[model samples]
Target: MSQLFARVVRQAIATFDRKNVASFNKNFSVLKQLVDQLTPCDINLNMDLTTDEAFSRVGKAPVTYVNLMEDEEFEFSVFILRSGFTMPLHDHPVMHGILKVMSGSAMIESFTKEEATGSAGQQLLYDPDAVRIEVVQDEPRLCTNNDESVVLTPTKRNYHEITAVGGVAAFFDILSPPYDSNIPFYGRRKCSYYRVIPRNGESGKRTLERIPPPRDFYCDRGNYEPPDFLRA
Candidate 1:
């Protein structure tokens, strides 16, 4: 199975064509077929997580990275998540993507930006006032060991966040034109951010409950602070 995945990775990289998006479209099934062969039951498929320590706290956040053929219209990255991990609601600029949970269950939330407003504009660098957020999809979706994957793109379900709900969840992802700088994170009804929001009690679990969804519809502001360990 590793050999097959390796071959598919190579094929994905080789198929990168800057001028034509169809190059990737033509080879899409190759990737789909390759990932189908992997199952959560196979421990050999565990992802190596030495690099992404910020996400390590949730458990292993192993990722398979691929380089695009310069000028290629699209590229791909695949990930293997341990039982309690998540990739929170985030956005990518001028690009589209997909996440097909190969096994287990996933809690996914999809959002779109709302127009900017009032104090939100002054407080946010991206004219937080200019941003508005809405929830498009939020639910626990079952992804069996060999089922169809989720699809994401600029046109389809474009912005979303995902969490591993059952055991480990593995997914295949595709992004077009690669990731650019203009992606955003949730701040309004679109998603929630983790901060030291005041809690009613000292209990660690209690803090989790006091947190509220982003009320201003903000996403991906570079000036935010993450957990200390995630700092590089």
Candidate 2:
């Protein structure tokens, strides 16, 4: 399975054609097919933490990530979320991602950034003063094993929130250009959270508002141990 995933990533990277958007579509299509084949048992996961009762403590981690491979080209991770827990609505910045449920299930709410009042027809990237001026609309959906969602560049479905449904859910996550941008002039490449609220005084209108993530929502780290074949 690891080797298969590696091939998928390799093909995904190879399909990265900056001159065309078709490459993005093709790469994501490849990843969706590959991710659908993964499951929690593939990594020896014991599903469902909701019944434990001890999981909701303030200092406890509601989610944990096991790294499969995170390099300059791509990142592969397995996210094990406790039942009833949530990973708040967040943006992937500039990235392409594919997520597939491995065990149990989850309800995923997805969104795409839209031109706001000030930046109509343009994306106000890294504009601290222009955030409130931009707008976004939410498109919600539910997903389970084999069910998937893909995020495309140029601000297409870049934000989402995930909730484990029925019981503990684990999913195979794949991200391209793996979340690291500590360079000068560019905002640090990291996850940013948000909330959907009425556009200030417009009671009938709603849009995304950036906010800090809940402190208690942090994840405990874990080591990667894929099927031995990939290691060999």
Candidate 3:
């Protein structure tokens, strides 16, 4: 790994290794700074590929991913979205995520679940067959290589939908305590999709209903070759 990316990986391990909240926060702050300074060149990613060339190499998949590294503590990968394609609304159950756009641009819309307020909240219906929950949606933002990285915690802005704008886009993604089937109380740390439920006349109330993953969306694995800079 490049020195910059190696530092990022070390910081990620340090951040997640902390049992104290204060220590984790301090380490995570440093991790964020390192992530912010990263660029496509850092990984020797080619942002200049023509659409035809990209499709020829990765096939016609709407999305393609190249896994860089993974361990019990974290998984680092790169996801590339075809033009006008979307990753759909999804939640990273009990995980912390950092996303930094490396090429092109993308629009990100994120949401955080709202805490129950009172008796009404307590009485809200929950069916394992059809799960739904109230959430606060953040304003949609366009992200580019120059934009600061986006961070999501287990509780805050934990759900998001990402769409490629204009043309193809790629972003570096890091998830700490990477999804696993052995999370104690949480059962499996699985990814779940959601759909926004219309609020009718209720102001400030938005609901997200769990849904099956879209049939049209699928990710294909891309060939991950070490960057040319690394060879040098």
Candidate 4:
């Protein structure tokens, strides 16, 4: 890892190990600052992967997860997005995280649940017009090579999707209390997909909603080639 990336992991530890909510919240911006300092080379990303090669393995492997640091407090990984690909909107269970663009650019649209949707596997009918919803990041802010960061929490913009721009894009992702069942505290990190539903004839920002996302997409897990300092 580079000195800058090491700094990010250090602060990430401090932020997740915080004893109280206020303390954790206070350290968020601090961690964000550290994440803002990362670059594509820090994680040894494959800058040469073409859009054709990337989308080729869509259901097989749409993104690459490069592990950096993993412990009790938090887990850090670099998620590389392929060209012309979009990570469909999804939820983060009860965890908190940070997304910092490490290379290329991305358009991120985030949202929060206006009403309780209950646990996964439960089926329910929904009325688009009746459900209360809000567009937290309406315009899908552009993020390029650590230029900006998006903070996520259980109550905040917990559900969102990301679209790669200008060929390929990647980000340094930090998640607290990782998605595990044994090390349970903030509940298991369960992920549920959702499909965005537009209101009536209006489109864009007029009104929007997210229903349980379809399960047609798929991907394969691959290993991360760590940098010199991050090598096991």
lDDT of 2 by residue, 1-232 (tens): 5465566656666654444455667666776776666556654444443234535667668887778766665777878788888988877766777777776778887776664323355444444333442445555667777666444453666778889887777777777657774433445577777777767775434577778787757888655556654465
Off by over 4 Å in 3: 18-22, 46-52, 56-59, 116-130, 227-232
Candidate 4 local lDDT, 1-232, one digit each (tens): 5787767766776787746556876787888877777676765666544244655653546676667678877788777777767888876666688898877788888875444453674422222233334434345688887476788876667778888887777777888767763343344445566656665554453234445555544444445576666565
lDDT value, candidate 3, whole model: 0.79
- Between candidates 2 and 4, the one scoring higher on lDDT is 4
lDDT tens digits by residue: candidate 1, 1-232: 3455456455555554444456767665665555556443222323332124423554322333222122344554445454666665555443545465655566665543322345645322222232333323324455655566665544334456567664655565666545432334522222234322223443321111113454432222112122222232
TM accuracy, model 2 = 0.76
The predicted structure with the larger lDDT, 1 or 4, is 4
| Candidate 1 segments exceeding 4 Å error | 1-3, 22-24, 39-44, 47-86, 111-130, 133-135, 138-140, 181-232
Q: Rank the candidates by TM-score, best first.
A: 3, 2, 4, 1
Give the number of the best model, judged by lDDT. Answer: 3
For residue 64, model 1's alpha carbon misses the true position, in angstroms, by 12
TM-score of each: 0.48, 0.76, 0.86, 0.74
Off by over 4 Å in 4: 18-22, 48-60, 115-137, 181-186, 200-216, 221-223, 227-232
Clashes of each: 24, 0, 0, 4
80, model 3: CA deviation in Å?
Answer: 0.1
